[model samples]
Target chain A: MMQMADRIKLKVLDPGLLTTVQDSGRWGYQAFGVSPGGVMDEYAAELTNLLVGNPPDAALLEITLKGPTLRFEEEGWVALGGADCGATLDGKPVPNWSAFYGRAGSTLILGFVREGCRAYLTCAGGFDVPLVMGSRSTYLRAKIGGFQGRPLQEGDVLEGINLVEARDEPGKIVESIRPERDSDLPLTQSSTITLPPSLIPRYGSPILLRVLLGPQEDMFEPEGVETFFNSPYRISHEADRMGYRLEGPKINHRGKADIVSDALAKGAIQVPGHGMPIVMMADHQTTGGYPKLGTVILADQYLLAQGKPGDEVLFFPCTEEEAIVAWKERRDHLSLVRAYVDRLWRKYA
Target chain B: MSVSENPSVRFLAMGEACVVVEFGNTIDPEVNERVHRLARCLQNLLSRPEATTYQGTFYRQEYRSWSEVARAGIRELVPTYRSLAVYFDPLEVKRQALEAQITQLLQEIDVPEPAGALEAEAGSQREKTFPRQGKTVIIPVCYGGEYGPDLAFVAQHTGLSEEEVVKIHTSRTYRVYMLGFLPGFPYLGGMDERIATPRLETPRTRIPAGSVGIAGTQTGFYPMESPGGWRIIGRTPIKAFDPFSDTPFLLFPGDFVQFKSIGEGEYRKIEESGGRP
Candidate 1:
């Protein structure tokens, strides 16, 4: 087996719609007006890391609707999760929620996403981006963190840490250091990971999300609340990383739909004077002035992030206890995935 | 506000992981004082290793058990004008139980109301007993030049001379209610009524950072280049936010602010010196 290099570089050939580096989230600085920006699909992003045997909070590339074309400069392992982007490695199809080996000069091309709005790509060692304020999530507005605090562009090079085991040599223990790729040397067999069928998320339309009625629920009329719960809202084209603007029945309010500006939490369904509901997302502003009817539960917020324009969404009101139970179940599922992945990697790798 | 020995604060669940504690409906300083106090208390309770050390008696038994879970569950406590939003992890604690415990904890802590608050009506103002404690930071500004693009518009809207407008603005000490909308952007309270100007009919595409502006009764400076409707009156040389700096923010919530007139030469000198203050 040929030794792999300590440092792996990824050269961007085509920067998709918007590919930003993200982790779990930037925490503890919201009080200072900094948003907890991170990957929109937490489940997908974390799953990608798990497939590559990376830490749960490891930094990964968040690819938007359109996908980027990247060329690997060194041998390493990588995994793709989230939206199905019809990925291909060196002209061969790459399946979602699975890890695959990449040799030097191999190109990874992610085409148009057919399912969700965003996808996540994780390298075994994670991206070598500096953490700002305890995270590598890119907050483009402030131009802070992740690859110069901006989206990936063509010609940009990203560094990755070496976090995988060294390739074995036949009947000998050679130096761990990896030699540069040369045309003269015979190539070694590359490793691959096949995820269980159950691990894959089913990307469906007309997603339903659970929500809990809120701090400003009293401001809305009973009919307004009814409309919010009963009707299906369509995601507007104006939606972005900050929030998803929805078009549906107008939510009537008892008074003006403005309040003294207050701190905002992710998933807040804020309705302005115009009555359209805007569900705050990963890159939402720290504070808001509009009255919120409810907040989508943490367990189901990832569904909202995965929705694309024209996607329909129905909100179901759930008790606080139900939300907590749902969140716990999701966490348990993640733990199960971690345990399963570890066993699989040990046996197969 | 007669201390009725009842927890007057209303706790509303924002979601499984977040809850908003509403102290009062309006933006009263007394209510804001209680909000901040509760935030600090909650932070202390969750950050401390032991909950038995808490002296509050209302939920003594609940605190002992809940604090253990809260020590690792609580993520953020954000204090607004009249409320506090507690963001926590649902994996560690149940929401209904945590809400009840939080209500008990708030009831135990005594909030000092304004003098004669009990007899005061909704519109009537009471004597402020809990005055906010903050430092008065003097910000230097260069008004009515290339830096202040909408200075004439503000003057025209207020129907006051340019010099009188500056005098009215610099005279009052405004309170920094909160930093939001943009990083380090202060939501200043207490602008002079005489100089109040309506927001522009159409917001400009770009307002440079540190451009002081007036919108209705509010006055604030832009912390970064953003689209805004506020009528620009002056420009400050102080860099309100710097991501790379040790203290990224120049001003924070509860800080007092005042403006001092400066010339272009002084503005240039301060900008060249890194615009620390």
Candidate 2:
């Protein structure tokens, strides 16, 4: 029998804004009544895990808005990414996105969030966590993951189940490269990490979300579809991990209801009975019964995640091939950034 | 095994990653049985490689491609009442070669018992396959009062007393339909329509975890406390999810869940006794 609790334990003296353990995502069991539970910021979570040399799907703490204070029982290397919640290490502000060494008895306080929503904290070898439906991310709605399928509270401890590491692995801990803290921060220091100049706002001054016609594209009249692409829409207050609601013109259907609870993907803009658009997010349902008007390109999801409720958004139509190409370009860009980071780790540290 | 060709089943491509195949439409025992069998066969094959399988209302396995990009092959086998159109690019796929292999390998499969085929509706099935975990847990839940804040309201909606509402809820067996909206929140099926009611018009920003509720004709349990509008009737002491447990999900799809009413004292006693859900 494995004595799991003894290895790595954390006393969560306080449960920051909203902290949950998450990985890339929960997969392969949605049909069996299991939810696709995982981290909201997949990019930051994966990057932090890779930085610490843990397997891609290893679990980490996802701090939402606020952060929790933890006391670790063992010495380990940890990294934080996404959202600049002012994380303090023994009363000192720690740099974001770099590895930090914490002593066994040291108390780590993560509290950095001014604009962005989520922050990911990854351990040296990844938090030795358990997997539910083959994922380590905590899905609170289902009450099935993290610490006991619940959020961390005062006095809750976490244990690490990683294999013992050699004192000398070829890995280098670089502490200089931090994710830009400014949601409004000017990208002056680094060129590669900065948003591409080509990604500048195109549809006038407001940020209009570009989308592709959905599978049920013919459900709406040509004019309705035209209005969908041309008109400006405001995001409604009802927004969360599931999907986002949009307030716009009441779109009329050409024929009968075009949707019958078929499958739904991230970024699918579906129109329910109320004739309003609902844009599905990262933690969206596998299927929906609403008529889909459009689907946002995968490339633009990052911007959507940063969008707060009541923000002004526009829907522009794009070709499916364009969406596919755009996704590839985004992936290629991510690779370049990772390579640059790899090189910088060796140059510094 | 000299099999000719699969009548209703074939490989399908989902975007750039998963290959999907279906059996029929409608949720009869036959379609479900075949979905389960086919998933096990493909999973046995997938295990030999590193392809990760995503079994939901469909079966999809994500592949690690060049440039570190991930793609999945989606296979949905839920038995809808009619034919399901699976859209994909046929030209991009190695359909001829893959079809040959699928046919040959399918010969090795035993159709299980009664679930032979979807009666050849020109090859169409809506049955999507979800993954099955090993452990089947029987969870104990405490109903009514503080545990379920809206229990009495649900009783009123159902035209029954709170005790009668509890009786009907705990009586019928339920199966997980899908997990969505939140982590570990199971949308279970098989609820009696007698207790069916619409969700609250206004959603609460904070619905406590383990709060079981009924909506329209569906019933489910809330695993975490969050914003929800479901007509909550009661709560359970057992936690459905724990990121720290060896197996984080307490309830798997297809596994049965029954509610057991306990007093306030029993609820705390269960919590104190370390009775995890």
Candidate 3:
């Protein structure tokens, strides 16, 4: 029913390591054994969407480690967030956590990640993938949703939907917001709109993740709990979207390690008989049999998601009240940024 | 409905976002029914609009409206064997507020007696009173030979003939406790102890979908091709999970299932006719 010309499109020249389409998540269906598959870093994904003047829940390309080579078929506003992926447009360097206007036929190439594990890319209209079970996220194991329910391959074309036509000239918004540009200089090319340095998230190794212990923390012995908190674990190479298996101290259980299978919360640290804790992630199953030691707080989960394989992870125990407060602070920070971005868009566009 | 005098419930925090309301430790039908019932009640309450005032016994003046609670972001409710995990957004609702609401709902539920105990009291009344009233799903399974490589092993372990094993397996109705492990893979209860067998010491890397397998006292069929430890005694032609269909899952918690033994020729016929037996 929609005209092809009205929608902007992007073609994958070379699909990077594990590029997939993701949105907020496929919610309200976990009880039916469905995984809440979404972007690993929700904060980054939301910021990327906001940068492009799109809704926070818009479907965006989630690039893992290596990035993709995509060619814009039409002129569109695009933004990069999360990791510093060393992206370049037509061989010209593009800064991270910034928005820029890509001309039609311009090839955007993303090199290996200079920092962080995953990166997010979004256009002004968002990807036009058919929503499966009320989500556009790609749950690779189930092969549902997103661009054909799997990782993007070479030659896969993606269309941008719900384009908001700017009232002013294209690239004029970026020109007006240019902090360092002189007032006398004429705006010929589209300038980049970068977030303030204080607003950008800093990714680092040996990430300290604060956890709210329990749901099944009593299953572990006092010594096991002590070991869990005392020792630093390295992210195993076996890590993927499903979970990150940590290798460090073998946390012993007081009795049997297995419990009658129960529902798994997001960021649950499940410890099996082997004693190694597996931090369940975006694509974790609805339920698991192993006893959980603790769950990483929602606010710190972004740092955990950005953690690379072999990265050191230190867990700190926090109370439920503290966890709630941390989440509120994160939400307040995002709201501030959203308001700032909306004001900028209103003045320039 | 007459509410239970005092049902033992524990509110365990899964994280800041979720609270696991555990009914009991064991996988009894009564406890599982309560889990499903609570899930249904919460779902019904959440679906209602914001303006409607709830006049329940558990309503407290300090708590906000039902729709405000809903707006506070009750994202998902997952019902398991003895517990229901309620996942909500901590940014919108505090952990204590969500737990208090769930505790209130738990107090309102009428805990049914054990199935055996209720059956003796009033047979006709039991049917009407039961929480799950859905029709039993009959799964046609072809036992032995090439379809089930572990059939002989199961029979040998149980000290029963292969035919006797099949007969006992199909004799009783099984309760679908929950769907987990794999998508639409029902964790079935009510298997005959005579046919009980431990899982394979070395788990097979690739078990075909529709394989009816038993591990310990539990029996279930794989919905998708996945590596499993459950000893396969038979294979079913029916698709346990059809992702393409409007109803993706074939089973849900509190549903009933019955196995019907069929010959290999019938299995082939059903498989050829798109799993409609």
Best by DockQ: 3
lDDT of 1 by residue, A1-349 (tens): 4554556679999999999999988887676688888889898888888776676788999999999999998766678899989998889788777776677899999999999889999876678898787788899988889999999999999888654452222101111323244331112323345566687666657989998898789899999999999998999998888999999989999888899877788999999988889999999988898998899998899998999999999999988778878888888888788777766565443
Model 3, residue B100: distance off in Å is 2.4
Using TM-score, give the best candidate's number.
Answer: 1
For model 3 chain B, the run of ten residues with the poorest summed lDDT: B49-58
Per-residue alpha-carbon lDDT of model 3 for A49-107, expressed as tens digits?
A: 88766777789999999999999987566789998899998897888988776667989
- lDDT value, candidate 1, whole model: 0.79
True A-B contacts kept by model 3: 0.66
By TM-score, highest first, what's the ranking? Answer: 1, 3, 2
Give the winner by lDDT.
Answer: 3
Which scores greater on DockQ, model 1 or model 3? 3
* Each model's iRMS: 1.4, 6.0, 1.3
What TM-score does chain B get in every candidate? 0.78, 0.66, 0.80
Cα error of candidate 2 at position B141, Å: 14
lDDT of 2 by residue, A140-207 (tens): 65566566777878888776554444222213232222232333111223322222234221112244
lDDT for A14 in candidate 3 is: 97
How do all models score by TM-score? 0.87, 0.61, 0.86
Q: Which stretches of candidate 2 lie over 4 Å from their true place?
A: A1-14, A68-76, A86-93, A102-112, A155-163, A166-210, A255-259, B1-277
lDDT of 1 by residue, B93-183 (tens): 6666667777666655553442454545311221121123556899999998898777787788779889889999999998777677887
Task: Report how far residue A324 has shifted in candidate 1, in Å.
Answer: 1.3
